[model samples]
Target: MAVDPSDKKALNIAMRQKLFAVATSRDVAAFEELFRYYGPRVRAYMAKLSRDGQFAEELMQETMVAVWNKAAQYSPDKGNVSTWIFTIARNQRIDHWRKANRPDFDPNDPAFVPAEIKPADAAFDMNEDADRLHRAMETLPPEQLELLRLSFFEEASHGTISEKLGLPLGTVKSRIRLAFAKLRTALEDRS
Candidate 1:
């Protein structure tokens, strides 16, 4: 049966609601629909922002992986799916740029490795703890994740990330602070 276009908006709303519910429930088919729908758009967006075909394709995959992993937290009331998905793609591109441009550091430097951490116990499963941490990370807001990624992985100076992302430096700092606070709260009671 041919789908009518007259009620596209309503159809989109219903699809989003259903997809959001299914994704939250870990239904693979519903999540696949979202991936196929937005994957190309994300690739095109990253291509435009990066001006590199291969880089764009790579970042697109990264963004989609993040979306798959984080879909449960999506909220249609807070923002449309496109906006939320695009924001993730944009942040991934920014992160790629930052990593490509990070200053080279000497591997021989002793300070690069933490001294106090125990070497013998490093390989412990700690499966229960890790599962808890993953759940907490899943709960973080997109804005907070973006800020935290920029601050820690990109290591973009507050002024630079703010300028690059067109956000105020204070806002960037605030979001990173909040992201860390959330992580701390999530881990406070764990052993």
Candidate 2:
């Protein structure tokens, strides 16, 4: 059977949508289909990234497991299925690398670690600095403070904060910049 390219593309998208729905609903068949479709590709990608077939295979399995567990976190509006899957694969690879290279330490070895107590004066200075920063933050306008909170404390990108708050990107950036400048000046004066 000769299928047109457009038809193939449409079929792929349809299958992806169905797979997402099934995965979201915790269907074993859907997970099997997804694994069958993406497993080899993920393995190849991880192998290329890690340059080790055995580790890549392990990472691929872990990625698929993570996808199965986090399928419900997928949002079509954020990205497509391939991107979501690849992101998981990439994270699994990173995690595998971190685990493989982690250093083992013995808690009882005096030569393995050093504990230094902070001087009382240094602790008092740190507390004063924190209080000063808190007071400076309080001096910011409500809107600017909210932008700062979203950008720093919440660790959200400015674009995301803009979209979430229904504000323009430029406005969000400018507000955050202004807030930061105010904080810097206030903190420096106190110092």
What is the TM-score of each predicted model, taking all chains together?
A: 0.49, 0.51
Candidate 1 lDDT tens digits, 1-191: 12243666664675576467556677777667667777888888888877889988898899888887877777878877778888889888788779989988987678786577545456455656788787778889988887777877788889988998899988888888888888889888564
lDDT tens string, model 2, 1-191?
Answer: 12233575664575466567666677887678778778998999988987999988998999999988888777777766788889988887777778879988778788856887899999999899899999999999999999988888999998999999999999999888899999999999878
State the weakest 10-residue window (summed lDDT) of model 2: 1-10
How much is 179 displaced in model 2, in angstroms? Answer: 59
**Model 1 regions more than 4 Å off:** 1-8, 107-191
In model 2, which regions exceed 4 Å deviation?
Answer: 1-12, 108-191
